[model samples]
Target: MKVLRRWTAALSALSLLVVALPASAAPATRWEPCPVAGSAERQECATLTVPLDHRDPHGRKIDLRISRIPAKGTSRGALVIIPGGPGNSGLNRPSTVNFPAEIRESFDLIGFDPRGVGQSSPVSCGMAAADARRLTPWPGPDGDISENIATAKRMSEACARNGGDVLRHISTRNEARDIDEIRKALGRSKISYWGLSYGTYVGATYATLFPQRTDRVVLDSSDDPDPRRVARGWLANYAVGFEDRFPDFARWAADPANPLRLADSPDAVRPLFLDLAAKLDRAPQDWPGAVPPKLNGNALRETLLRGLSTDAGFPLLARTMAAARDGSPAPVPVLPPDAVLQNISAVAAATICQDVTWPRDIDRIARDVQRNRARYPLTAGMPANAGICSSWPHQPAERPVEVTSHGPANVLLVQNRRDVATPLSGAWKLREAFGRRAVMVTVDAGGHGSYLATGNACGDTTVTKYLLGGARPAHDLHC
Candidate 1:
């Protein structure tokens, strides 16, 4: 009876939007083998055609590339997988993620390329290689944002010229709408969701907008659902997030068994890194093959942020840090060529700027940077720094989604304790937003991504059980 009530209410909200019929949009026979390797051979691929603007159902259309690994056993429905990176091609997830046996047995593991990403109607701003460096979100070492400000304006203008109308529509809300369109195309009245990173924000918004349509939603590594801040806030929180995650790196770097020991004790590691960055700021080094080929303070800081995502990245960061200190050549990680970044940077800029308005006032931002630098020396005010969003071409399309607990209690929220990207504090904010509608599982783990990435048996098992058997804990549980 309770499920019926929820279903009815969901259909009521969904009625406001035009729902595609399966036979017309996609046929079961349309499934073809996916092109990516390592994925199960039976995995099928398809394209979903959706409107560029949800407001005009009969307008310009875009194709969303999608893939699915069919269930080998009893099926509940489709478990739509939302990938991270407002820029990731979800269609390729099966190639990397080894979905556990239970989920594979119970539901069709599905993925898709959100609009304006890989294989979809892709967009790029044509930003130069040099422009990418000048427009990094972090301010100059001396808190000078003048160059960053000018570069951002040029980048924003390029995107406006190159991106056209697509830029305005690449937002979380539209992404959620695209998900619903996929759900309808699959002939499912209700569907389950497993979203990670930015995907979590996408899942939460989907639940709030179409509660009845949601079944067994799992939001891993969540961000704060504060409507006002959006992606701008996520960039700023890097200061706090990095401080929380860097210690784990320090301990690992200082370990006796570790080949790359940067310090004698974990306590020594923080100062050692800070000193290294300061020295690099004063005297930059040249690496013939690196992205900029010149290692400066900002590059080191960027490297630190990069390494804190997972412990797997620790050794790489440490080795590079040591090489920079000793003036020895390090195998600097190659960034994806500028051509790829053009697509990535444009999508990132569009989704963030179109989702919420960023303050364009340089004076105010510079003051904040200095204040942030003083408070969090480890991150050096990079978190509070501005990016191209400050000079974004247009105002936000709509207000940011205010996530509420008014939806069905079908959510399982998973979070890591020491995430440098989506910190537990931010996850707690999302948990609070979900209210009575969700049960959270706080994993006693570190790193940015939880679930399989953390390798926490307790966290993964708890989530997998609920996903496989639609049973959630009565209250929030700690692993």
Candidate 2:
């Protein structure tokens, strides 16, 4: 899940499986050239219709946009590419992402826009642009959440008013079911998977629900798969994740050769950033072309959240911080189209909110925020603050899927030690949940995704070897 201002930031299960139709009764998928420009000639697009509610297999149906890049050599099977964000589109990944030649040649790479995303029957809350920016409940400069509570109520009401039945049915468990449908459509009983960020959870859920159907599974940058906490835990992790990842940026920002250097030493960097954020809270700088049109403390924090995801983004973040600290002309923040944001916000709200129940008591939530603010000043308690889910009109369609070590030992977990979004601590929880069923490779690196990212040769080699050949270290390995 990508960072959004305030609270909106961005699940799994199995029975269980949905009843399948006879092979002759199932619709035959016809693959045609993808409509996206610059898409590779090898890539083809198709649509698979899935039940809106898996329980009611014979009821209303929705289409999922899927893409595939056939193998270069004799294919072993399919490798499904799952994108992050309960909202991110995966249909173009088969063409956009550069996979190693060996892996691409060994299997047919597949991608899809999960239900309620992209061309897969998208949903919206009909929220005004301003309301969308208020998705996260960042407190006032004085640590007051009065406005945050009000914003939550408004956003919740808007979603209930505008989001249709599609929003109600959007969930992690359903997504796993959809993947199973894709497997059936492709005429494969078992498939390999490569999932990133939130996609890791989707992959885990698929593996748990259909353990027998998963061949080789790779979960990169995992989320804590605690069914009780669910998305709330992911949100709260930002407080610790930011602290863990900040030092890496601090080292880069304090380097003498860096043009955007903010301090003389790494130790001075944290104080500098905290002071700058406090100053922004008191007086926001005008930032044209950005959502809310101002560079406030939370806006700066959002920049940190995104920038810490990759080393390539460090300079952009440094530049933004330098501008804020010096009161220089604010860099114009590029934003996605309003329609895109609307769709993402709606899907994020629905999936996170309906995955599990949240505290409806404003006072209970307020206490949590206050405590979080005191302990972790960098995030300013936003991670602990309640969002639209607290006031969400609907309840979860089913219980959150508990991912246990009940499946095959085919799972491989790869992680960055200091990922800001999905931190190592949270990944550990997932690792423990998988138990002996999964082998973890923790890279001594920073940023979010790990495999082929962060340039850790050992981590990359371990994951590649696992995908190419079914080999994993006898125990959890640290690179």
Candidate 3:
């Protein structure tokens, strides 16, 4: 009687499985000839409709502008490229960014504008560039919080008034769901992801929730996947991150061979920078039409921060510094176009504000800023300072995804030794969460993203070997 009962149960499971399988999968994306100038490889563009709110799948929908460069031959699967910047779009990575063409040719290079970014249904907070510049995560030069607090509230209000319901739904979880929807739309069961900077957090969240759906995952220049930190932590780390990455710039600037040499020695570079900033703070350059309309000390500081993001930016910083010191007409500052800035700021603010609640208390923020200044003067207490999120109108729609090591063993983390934005320390925290599941390739280089830029040949080779040939180092390998 017992054997008969077990057989009946097993037969019932088989019957359910047979009935559950779909006769045919969802329709594949229709391919078209997309001729983009300056692109040597064949590329195509299309849109996939995803829910604005995943909770109501049948409700309103938004188009995700997805681009793909199909493989030259038989493909492994779709290699989705996730761009950095909570505001950055992946839509141009395959063709625009300097991703290795050899690896790109091995698989379908897929890029998409995450919900409110790029060619997708973009959202704007209607913020002027001037207003955006004033609202800093960093406090004022003297650690004054009055303006910072006001800006925070004003910025939050601007977002609340300008960014509507769609803003509330732009969390990492929703983005991950959208990714799965893209997978379904493309008729793929699994996908390989290559995420940079903030995209690392997004990719990690996707892996946490849909482990089985991930393949050949590469998190380059990772953020602290800490639920409490989220964007808050990334914002705060600018101070520390700049400190870590600036030294590399200093050494390069000190090199006499460089046309835009700053100082005689690496030691002189640091003090020269500090002195220049202080002098400028007292009296800004008379340049017009720049971000602040005058090249102030903070403007120089901000340029330094961006310059240190990668090794390629070293010259920009040195030349700018040289020109400023020489009292030459300041080079025209090139900020993103107005429309692009609006879209980016809206997405960045909404994502930060909606992901989790930042401290609303001004006193605590002020104190943190004070401490931050004393400890790290490069950013002058900005990282610890409050911004728009402090006074965000709505509550978080969902909890931050807790990244764990429970996912498939296909995760690979490639990091630079001294990245200012996503430092090695934070990457270690992410590595700890993933435990043995992720094998890290720490390159002995100083830049934000490791796979291609600023990374040594070994690091790029390792990542390419993994993405193309499905090979991962047996252990954490330092290149």
Candidate 4:
């Protein structure tokens, strides 16, 4: 990822009160057991009743599905796992992600499906399955976004027409409010949080709005929260991210002894992959049983970019590239199951469009596409173009909260040097915004999800220290 480093002084003037909150009021409704399919012994589930709209708290309510794994020892506080995807469900994460035993001993590990996601009152734009499948317009061979614009318009219109009133409320500000409600429901005055990917934004928003209620915050794979350019900034970041991380893939693919090696030399791999993508663009090769079944340029590029998100996915890219080059049809990884896809699409679009205003002018997007294509050929121009936000029907529910240094000095950001999803360049923007309120641990590794997944000991230790004990490094640390 492109590393854009900047720093600023911390703001400490805001005299926020850290008052003890009262116990949760007895709900007019009763709670129910919302259990996962298996692993019933280690975890327990419950539903928390929160208002559909915080402004009208006494009005209609929605149920937020929450899961908890009690601490082994006396608990210091509760640690909430804020899952990413804006649409992801954290209800199952505690068991799957293997919550740290030491941290779990000191705190009750909590996870939940955010409002309008998962077991929480889910919302769908009600798009036709076929339309929804084709809605994500993969950019053309030359990086033209004319088709993407059309797709965005159609998608936005479909969502507006079919999505109910709940769809209008799927913004990040609302999600933050939902977090506050969750806190109230959990009977905690302050909470420690672990947020990943877009969850980092939600966690930051919570800290910004209710800093006094935040005991500790760990923003992993941090994202730039510049309100003026939200997802636009995220999209543009891929240009730099792909450039930074692609070399790692190249080195892996070029290693001679590696069974999945695609090229003889690291330098030769990039152009070779590019050539294959271009060849497929002109004449798509058939892949049996794969969705759409044809290997097109955008599909190849999307596959490559998605694979770069983590180390586990590296060999998949290498194998796919090798097969494509040999003219043998390679199987595409199965897309997430339909229910999962629907939930994720809804949350991703809602959080992104809710957080900021997108440029409505097609000419602006056309210009961006032209520039991004010229600068970064690997991702083509998809990273620079507009998404469903371009045609969103409703205005953003609230102004995007500017993440400032006004909060407590309890945030610790961990980032990988080359993260394709949330790149180092964006991480710097976040670091600048947080000022002295945060100390970033920049790992010398590649891929996303820095602390546990990136395989960097220094970065992991820095974050673990902060989480287990309230310790902060004297200055910004580079590992």
Give Cα-based local distance difference scores for all models. 0.81, 0.85, 0.79, 0.77
Give the number of colliding residue pairs in candidate 3.
Answer: 1
- 1-479: candidate 4 lDDT, tens digit per residue: 11111100010111122123222221211234445566543766667666677777767677677777667887777788999876888887766665556876787777889987877878777655544665344577777777777778877887788767677778788888888766655556688899998889888889899998998899998888888987778777878889999999989888998888877899999999899899999988898877767877777887897789887788888777876788887857878776667667766777788778888898888888888788888887778777788887877877888999997898988888989889988988988888888988899988888867866778887877788888989898999
Which tens-of-lDDT digit does each residue in 12-80 have in candidate 2?
Answer: 121112123222122346677775577554778777777889998767778888888888887778899
Per-model TM values vs. the true structure: 0.93, 0.93, 0.92, 0.91
Q: Write the per-residue lDDT of candidate 3 for residues 389-408, one digit (tens) a residue.
A: 88888889888999998978
lDDT of 2: 0.85
Runs of candidate 2 exceeding 4 Å displacement: 1-27, 39-41
Instruction: Return whichever of 2 and 3 wins on TM-score.
Output: 2
Between prediction 2 and prediction 4, which has the larger TM-score? 2
Q: Candidate 2: deviation at residue 440, Å?
A: 0.2
Q: Evaluate residue 445 in candidate 3 and report its C-alpha lDDT on the 0 to 100 scale.
A: 92
**In model 2, where is the ten-residue run with the lowest total lDDT?**
3-12
Error of 4 at 333 (Å): 0.8
Off by over 4 Å in 1: 1-29, 133-136
Clashes of each: 0, 6, 1, 0
Q: Arrange candidates by lDDT, highest first: which order? A: 2, 1, 3, 4
Residues 246-360 of candidate 1 have per-residue lDDT tens digits of 8899899999998888889999999888888888888888877887788888888888877898888887899879977898876687677677777777887888889998998
- Model 3 residue 401 distance off true place after TM-score fit, in angstroms: 0.4
